[model samples]
Target: MDSQSAQLPIKIARIGSTVMNDFLKIPVRTEETSATALPRGAAITISGSWKGSITISSSDELSRRIAAAMFRKDDNSVEARDIADALSELTNIIAGNIKAILPGPSQLSLPMTLETVPEAAQGAVRVQLQDDQAGQLLICVQPGLH
Candidate 1:
């Protein structure tokens, strides 16, 4: 990994802990692991001097768990919109934090949730964070393709 890529996990852990408080744990970079199939998630693109995207993804179960924590709802009570909105906000916040550390003068596009992982995310740097009770959070950072 390049120097910038190597620094991402530390920023992610710090930002996620500060933003999510007790709801999120420190994220760990998952190396030498097969890709987890993410059928649902969210992404935010960063453009300008550096262009790329930051995606936060996971299984439906984890999505709902994150939504519950974000919305203060019971896990069983999270709605589809809740999941989508929570994921979108989470992705946006992560991307924003990353943008601050990266060579900037960049712009962050509005966040969007996906029902399936995008093909462009292949080969991105990925990290995984586990919740205390149950669920996993996968964060992918893909530098822009010039």
Candidate 2:
């Protein structure tokens, strides 16, 4: 495993906390749980000095809340596509930060919003976050060249 992979959990947690807080205006903290809502979020591939991908799987409630905050709308009025876009934006910010810290020549692909992570990524290391005031969001980091 590359050095970056070894420290992925901490890096992801820090990145996620900052990104979600900034964009969604919510506090995000690491927590453990196997339960996640159906239909996840985005996939961002990493290459060069280290290779892998990051995926954010979030609960429906969490998605709507984020979307609502991002667009300055009520949660009940948030659209499905907007929720996906919010997830994409969140993934982009966190992934961008992660890419910046990796050994150079490292390249980050554009965010690909996904309803479900591919089977291969199901086995990846994950960092789960809890928003005490809202729902859950999980960040999965698959280690390997894609």
Candidate 3:
């Protein structure tokens, strides 16, 4: 793990773990969960009401590719647009579930594409999941920053 990831707040960590456990049913080791790859890694940040960013990264490109493919539409069967839409819907459901646990009236915006950047950016708080094959769930609260 790097210095930045090590400094994540406990509250966010707890929320991340809870999201994975309750929503995704994925159990992870907290120590290993926070470790992120250096370069050519994937870090996703979902910032909105329930504040904290969660990153799921791996050195393996195959994993990411598979995830992309599975979530995309093909000519033979499902439409690529539909797959993308489904993923966004799933993100909303998970975020709503997480919001129920938090204190206050914060709403989650629908999950949008993070886009491909030259390098992954450092988010407010880092949340790395247990399974690399598993997509991440992050909801970073910015308070009254809106």
User: Which candidate comes out best when scored by TM-score?
Assistant: 2
Q: How large is the C-alpha RMSD of every model relative to the true structure?
A: 3.1, 2.6, 7.3
Worst 10 residues of 2 by lDDT: 115-124
Per-residue lDDT tens digits of candidate 2, residues 1-146?
77766786788788888888886788888886663534668889999886988777787788888889888999899988898898888888887887787667788888998956554445477778888766788877677856
**Best model per lDDT:** 2
Tell me each candidate's TM-score. 0.80, 0.84, 0.43
Compare candidates 1 and 2 on TM-score and give the better one: 2
**Candidate order by lDDT, highest to lowest?**
2, 1, 3
lDDT against the true structure, per candidate, is 0.73, 0.79, 0.42
- Model 3 is weakest, by summed lDDT over 10 consecutive residues, at 37-46
Give the per-residue lDDT of model 3 (tens digit) for 1-146.
56534543454557656654565444543443544442222222234444543233323332333234445523245443544444444445545554555553655554663333133244444444444444433334222332
Would you list the rank order by TM-score, best first? 2, 1, 3
Q: What lDDT is reached at residue 78 by model 2?
A: 90
Error of model 1, residue 134, in angstroms: 3.9
Superposed Cα deviation of residue 110, candidate 3 (Å): 2.0
State, as a TM-score between 0 and 1, how close model 3 is to the true structure: 0.43
